[model samples]
Target chain A: MSEADPVLLNPEVARPYLDRGGDLPALPLGPEGLDRHTRRDLLKEEMAIAKEFHGGAMWPYAVAAFSCFAVWLAFFPLAIMGELNLTVGFVLSCIFATGGYVTSHEAMHSNIGRPGEKNRWLNEAVGAVSTIPIVFPFSMARMMHLEHHYHCNDPVKDPDYTDEAPNALWAWYKTWYNRQPGVDGSIHHYKRILAGMGTPEAARALKETMLLQLVFMAVLFTMAWSGYAIEAGLLWWLPRHIGLSYIRFYLSWAPHHPREGKTGRYEQANIFKSRLGHVLSMGMETHMIHHLYPGIPNHRTRKAYLALKPVLQQRGVDCSAL
Target chain B: MQAAVRGLFSWMPLLFGIGFIAPLIAQIMQRLDIPAPAGISPILFGLLIGAPWGLLTVVRGRWL
Candidate 1:
């Protein structure tokens, strides 16, 4: 889609609206524009360039998931046996758990597997297992994520865009938590939307996984009741707490906020210009370009954005987010 | 059936909010007998109680 053209500076310099009493006409479509054939050809050319860094590898996601699992699980026993400080162990485990969630996010997008029919389910399954420790249901998460993409930046329609007005951090927190009842009502509706799209089986799969939250609760209680409250708190609860906050604050707030007052549909997306922000956010920092072409997997979004930088600039699309 | 499920879920955050806070309120009343802080409005107290419940309901967010 084309960016909105600037309005004419002088009424005499504008094409007059036939019915207008005194209004200047909007940008008109014309014969002098790029033809349909050329548009398609150019898009195909850019996508081909994007494909070079677009990954279809499962090993990296697997390695990230396994790293989280091993490091987080190992922290428990070592802390219990007094080999490592409980607080330190807990802090370190939370960091690794956040890494695991990055894998889960990739998995949700079906980017953790080879681009093939058979590997789709494999990706979802790996995501499900990887997210269990964080109390996330993969199928459910997939549904919501698709909605986020489908309705990005829509205040009413998108679940992620809660605060429509600007406010301080504490004010937003208080508004989100203390004020709202029945929050995330968008999720139940989005589930129906997904099911209606011929993925009823995926919806049913999500329903079945709701019990896992209870199972997670039971696991925590069992650990706490067995006189390992500190261990349970650190290894289980703390890391997941970190995971939850990291997802909300880092992945959610940081990537979308700081709009520099430009809330136009294409301009509102946030990008990380800093290397640390890019690394920490799993490459979601260069987000506006990714949103332009959602099919370009996360690992390669930065590369794809850079590849199309000239085009974005020439089109007058804002890349200041980057 | 879909509407009914949706209605039920729409109430869940409110229910979970009360569930999470009612016990905490009870514990405070039993142990410390804490009163509403001086100069705190009833509306503010209500919000404080509701916020954690809301926070807990959503912190297990599926997306974002």
Candidate 2:
């Protein structure tokens, strides 16, 4: 099949099992325990498939960054001439943040260029421009993130999992204070992330966050002393927060929560099921496919995900909505 | 659905005012014996409350 076949490329049309739901069958745990060589070959095949979607041309990163900067410039007048249009400013900031974030994201995966010293410097530069520097040390984030991929939804281990603790008083408070009757539980769950970030692990994350903040502050101060601080903050600082917050919110939670029959952590659910999910998340919405094959790059995931959905469903896994 | 809409309308304003507003509202709602809904965060709550204020600023010609 051609690489760009609609059926192959689109998860929505290819994976019907997510929408047509019933109980899934159990996944095979290496039938009869194959020999080492056979298993190695299978793994190699999987890795090859995963690598097929690896790396996009670097131009998208430049394009995204420039577009984001233009948008921020357009909004600069609103922040300067008007009375702190918090909403528009905030929304605009979010856009900036997302741009910064996406660039940083590409850098993390070394998608901007070849791997090594050159790539490292470029990645760090991109990350610095994004205003979230500490996350640039991909070795650290990759270590944590890889663990997250391996044990997604494992409450105790997954950095992304923010479900309530069963026995904790804090958990009780969360349920009482946040759990609304009818709306999707995303807001409550997201609150848990915000609150949880205050915890020890989050404190660690914050330390890393602060390092970047310090660098950002220095830049701001330099601009201010140069008599261009207000312009700099408008052009850079303010918009960065807006974009980052929106992108973080948009990217982080939507793929996981609001699914049916999902309960405690370790439920092994794929929550991105709709066309909206795919579009809004920039194709990250084929979540079940992601969990099944974490090595698959973002671009090629939809097709691979769809190809495996039927098998995954037969194994009793809950595919996402779309 | 009506209850959902009512809850959203009520909460949206609170959420938008400040980043911490949602958590504060969630805290208060818990204390008042009111049912708090799920899936909302303090940040988003702040955005919700902030949106209208922004619109008002625009409407009043305060935003240039």
Candidate 3:
């Protein structure tokens, strides 16, 4: 190829960049992509294979945990020094930050590590660290996500979708967990699950969390108060919005928008056959697999999808439009 | 023309890092009492260097 030859935005090259770390964003299986009958059949037939893709690892969790810190660490000072342009540099930070969040989603599921406090602390820690760029509280997001999975799109129940999904970029526009109002801002749901905890201890922990938050905010506002307006815009506020938008774009808007209001195995999610789809969302392009088999981790969603695809298609699942 | 646009988008990170990031960093260094080896509006110098670097990197990343 000549120097000026056009470069195709092919899968192998583009997918990695879009996927950030190895975790692919989950693509919906196809809104209600699988009928309940078919879903049951799939479970009976392919659940074993999907199960093989389950379980978690440690080293990958460390990479994802530390990488999130590394990205913010690098982006902040550069942003502080004005070494980064607001548009491009902030976007870069968003990309890395989104990667951290994506992996952190798995951490929420304990897919990248142990679950149920065997790995709960690690999971929550990674999630908390990852959200720094976005300024969301990790514990709150985790509890909300657990509900999101339980209700999926149950109107008035799944805190995420109280109203009808707008006839628009519906999925992408759904409110984030902690970003919304009128819920447990301090992760009371999970705390409730933590049994036998006395009131005084709970009060103490809550007091500390609030204090830490107050101090953190005081420092940021102090800096911004002192004419780091552009710096704050570039590093903090801008990247937080960008990172959240990026995730919603790939995870919510792209997959859910196409097929909202569909029911069972046919819910408002779909699989994208295009490399760009896979590239943009990672394995999330196979979202149905994750929804149906939440136990399957990020790296394994695709593998399970490929494994069950034949069975799914045989039962009239929509695998068309690639 | 299309290639150029895509190239430009792909290369923004590099471009901004040089033009915007570099200059601000210089100013920050000066604020921290670091030696500049001379006097200057490091921000302006940074912009001058970064803009060209950003543009060229965009081209290289996209095409080559």
Candidate 4:
């Protein structure tokens, strides 16, 4: 099958497909019948099969999960008071910060609360607050993430395309390189895109980003000046850098490697086995399911992906890596 | 705001090293009782090392 054109996945369409599932037929679709269907048909069938796994107000999970960030934040004061060891704090902070993106990712897709839904505020709140550990503003992340979805692997338009590299080691290095001050990747690239958009939403995101950066620096400076510099570095700054690298590697680079020419819905993201496993990789091993049915929550993607693997194979997606 | 951002970033790396990292290094050196060269203050010694490293990282985009 040829690579499908890169087209926007409509959450409105994704919504119906995300509803609670109906009973599956006693037998799965046969190989002969699947072969007769096009990729789009298989995509719909896959969505139908996985629909059972996702729905309901995810705000509770979002709220409960926020304690992870709370705990990470608390490590700062705890370390300062000598109640917690800096080495232990640093390690836990890294894990919490690494996991922060997935919670915010759900909110980016409105899985926690769909637009116009009553709990939508909670979605935005979760999205906004969850990534403080990594110093990423939700407004910027949401806008750029939506763009990545619409553009997928379009080298020019995809904000995440910078994470692409020829090999694993370079991919890891690109994550750090992209964050360098002079680089036109990462937040700097997002700034350029926002400036070009000139929309109210874009302007607001830019404003929020600037404000967040200021706050981050202010806190670091304050902590340092107050003799808590070690606490600041161990609890927040170093952990953030580590988290960004890990998140960029697994969530951005790994799923979409060799991103040069591929732009299809099925071609943009692939399934891969992570040495860190599904949970440690932050549910990104099955990221193809996320690109297809974004409404599926992170915790459920593994099961959903397994159930949908047959259809994904039928659609000519490369499942060999998994 | 653009100017402010630019201005802030111009010295951000260096200032971060001086204000945050240097103090940490100084504290560590003091705890370990590592003598600063020429009897320079521990904080000064930390700044001497951390500031240049930060400057290089900002310019070269890597700590090493």
The most accurate candidate by DockQ is 4
lDDT of 2 by residue, A149-257 (tens): 6556665555545433343344333333333322223233332343454666544543454344345555554544343434555556556544433443444455555
| Candidate 1 docking DockQ | 0.08
How would you encode candidate 3's per-residue C-alpha lDDT over A1-322 as one tens digit per residue?
A: 2222222233554465467866432321212333345556665787777778787565575576677578667765676677766677666666666776776787677665565556667766777677656655565456556766776665533534432344434433443432332233123233333222345644444344344444444445454435454565566655666677666556655555443345455454566663465646666678778877777877777778888788767656676643
**Which of 3 and 4 is ahead in DockQ?**
4
**Candidates sorted by lDDT, best first:** 4, 1, 3, 2
Clashes of each: 3, 32, 30, 0
- Compared with the true structure, all predictions reach lDDT values of 0.59, 0.47, 0.57, 0.81
List residue ranges in candidate 2 displaced over 4 A.
A1-48, A66-90, A131-147, A163-208, A214-250, A258-271, A291-295, A310-316, B1-64
Task: List, residue by residue over A283-319, the lDDT tens digit for candidate 4.
Answer: 8888888888888888888888888888777776777
Measured on C-alpha atoms, candidate 3 has an lDDT of: 0.57
Docking class of 1: incorrect
Better of 2 and 3 by TM-score: 3
Across B1-64, the per-residue lDDT of candidate 4 in tens digits comes to 6788867776677777777778878877877889889989988988998899788867875555
DockQ metric, candidate 2 = 0.03
Candidate 1, residues A1-322, lDDT tens digits: the string is 3423333433444445434666543353222233345445556776677667666556777777776677667776786676878777777777766666677777777776645767776676668767766676777776677667777776654655653335447424623342233343323444445565576666664564546654655565455434455566677766776666566555656667653444554465665564467878667677776666666667778878888776555445556756
- Global lDDT of model 1: 0.59
TM-score: model 3 vs. ground truth: 0.59
Model 1, B1-64: lDDT tens digits are: 6566546555555544443333334333434545566766433454577556555655554211
**Candidate 2 chain B least-lDDT 10 residues:** B13-22
Worst 10 residues of 3 chain A by lDDT: A178-187
